[model samples]
Target: MEFAGCSRGSSGRALALAICLLALISLSCAARLSASSRQKLDVHKHLNRLNKPAVKSIKSPDGDIIDCVHISQQPAFDHPYLKDHKIQMRPTYHPEGLFAENKVAESTKERVNTQLWHVNGRCPEDTIPVRRTKEDDILRASSMKHYGRKKQRTIPKSADPDLANESGHQHAIAYVNGDKYYGAKATINVWEPKIQQPNEFSLSQLWVLGGSFGEDLNSIEAGWQVSPDLYGDNNTRLFTYWTSDAYQATGCYNLLCSGFIQINNEIAMGASISPVSGVRGSQYDISILVWKDPKEGHWWMQFGNDYVLGYWPSYLFSYLADSASMVEWGGEVVNSEPDGQHTSTQMGSGRFPEEGFGKASYFRNIQVVDSSNNLKAPKGLGTFTEQPNCYDVRTGSNGDWGHYFYYGGPGKNSNCP
Candidate 1:
């Protein structure tokens, strides 16, 4: 009876093992059915994607039909502006980052070639070659529109026909005594200096024209006037500069601190003369300041010496922010007196809270640098600073005007030839 019981127990154990195996097989079959159903669903979803309008066709290397239609859920070129645009895929030559260090060479052929179009940045000839396509025109059109209507529309004659005929370039168009002209002018001053405040001064970061800039009430035609009646004072010397014309306001006084030259108003890469005590104004180069900005494709203001002061992006406006459309070359003073009475409202004056350090001065040369030519230096006014030229020519015995006398130097030795 004991042997029979043991044998029955072993048989029962075997039967339990077989049941477990069958149960595992059944679970596996159910899992495989679930996986199959999932795969079918995925295939159905892909088929539904084929009906989308965004995708046009899909081609295979072996010339076999893949999905040939849009299988993507998101539509390409769905934007309202790009509804009519089409999408295409083709092998393209993109910089692999490995060859980026190498300088690309320019092609001798002017016509578009496969090799030339595929070339990348900064070729040996210093030109970037791009694949010629309709995209180029599109890019140009987009850029032209970026400046808005002001930049796109042509100028309509609003003034007299004679005046409009006299007007040439819209930029750097200088007017001297209500006359348009281009040249360099310089001047020297001899007067009593005033005592300045301990720390009162202003600094202008000129990104445009440079070379002696300041307001001199004693002299007119060059100094910038904040008001029609107001002029720089000698008593407080609040709204005045001596070194360069540009300055920063420190309260009610004008600080004759130095200005900085920046490249495109972004990169600081050049030197500037800072305002100091008894810093006698001299021929400071404004050319570098103008050239720096021009390198970034913009023109800067030139100073009394016909040198660039610095570049200002907003100078492109026909109307200046101050409503002063013209750049004055000399100084404008109240009653043409150094100790003139200050009466005009202080529009743009400031003073140092601590002490007086700076005063206003004058500016002379005014010219624009032509940036179209990519030369390293400024194109106009070859000299960095122009010497004093005679403004008041005296008629000689020979009936010819002496140009040298007006320049403040000794008259020319040679008679008029």
Candidate 2:
């Protein structure tokens, strides 16, 4: 009987231990599930904070992440509807349903009155006009809000060979006619050049303009850096631009990118372009646009050929109240150290050196459009049916628009006077 009792006691202890182990495991799983739920809720709350009702969470077909937003049809201050009259606002009967279709966030709607009427130069009858305004006041205001300024970086002449070209390699040219000032177009011929020192300088640059001596440079759209910044400032090449699928690399870098000016790394708006591991200089003849949106503290970079290069969002711009005094073009290095350990990108690499690595690229026709005319005409580079919007503002093909041409040396023809 004693032996039996002892055996029974041992069995009971083993069963109790097993039960405890199972209970611990179950409790651990529950805790994990609770944490996951909390994390998800936190993410949702943050997104809601953006207060953009137009945004919709979507799962990409390939399981990638993609979000969609509805374009608002309601006219803002600068739309054609508001061009002729002053705008005033009044509350609507059904505040919740007012912007239902447009999907503007609830928070945004609440901030401003539901019924707002925009006006032309004069104030609407009900509202008083402010002092010192013009017909183009709205446009000018928007431009200032969108395009601020650029940080300046004056490069020493001996920094990088490609960037420090003593022969005046770095340059910017634009049409000078007055009417063309708001909009201008010019045809430039790009010639391919044989690669010299094939690795150090790939003949690519960011175009800068302040009218050769002014204090502003236009941003390059869809720009990307590929080579690693190994020797620090010794390399001066930024590569690869494309407009479409068949339009591979620019064939050669001898055209507009013989040399480019370097300025402070301040960008009004910009994009990054990257080449794959095996691809080199396959696309060519590309155009880009940079614009600002005041409400959003971000600059935009657009890419395309005479036809189409999509717009990729880059959040690397700070708004400047003053105009950009300088524009930077090439990727010449001034130091031999790595550009700090840069963060990795899903798009591509920014470590490329102009002549050090593989093949690179070129750029041209750098121009600066003031806030007064940022949206009056397209930058003239994208794909537009009846001449580019840039050229649309032009009077015609010949001398109607002021023209600046950068022709490659020797056998190349610039197609300009």
Best by the TM-score measure: 2
C-alpha lDDT score of every prediction, in listed order: 0.21, 0.25
Candidate 1 has what TM-score?
Answer: 0.21
Per-residue lDDT of candidate 1, residues 1-417 (tens digit):
233223457677677667778889999999999987875565445334322332223222222121221211222222233344332121121112211211211121121111111122111211111111122222232232221111111111122223321112010111222221211222211111221221111111111222222221111112122221111222111121211112222101111111111111111111111211222332111111122232232223333222222322222222221122112222111111124322221111221112111222212222322223222111222111011120111111111111101111111112200
Model 2 lowest lDDT segment of ten: 383-392
Whole-model lDDT, model 1 = 0.21
Model 1, residue 55: C-alpha shift (Å)? 54
| Residue-level error in angstroms, candidate 1, position 277 | 13
lDDT of 1 at 410: 13
Cα lDDT tens digits for candidate 2, 63-83: 212222222311122223333
Q: How close is each model in CA RMSD to the real structure?
A: 28.5, 20.9
Among all windows of 10 consecutive residues in model 1, the one with the lowest summed lDDT is: 401-410
Quick one: best lDDT, which candidate?
A: 2
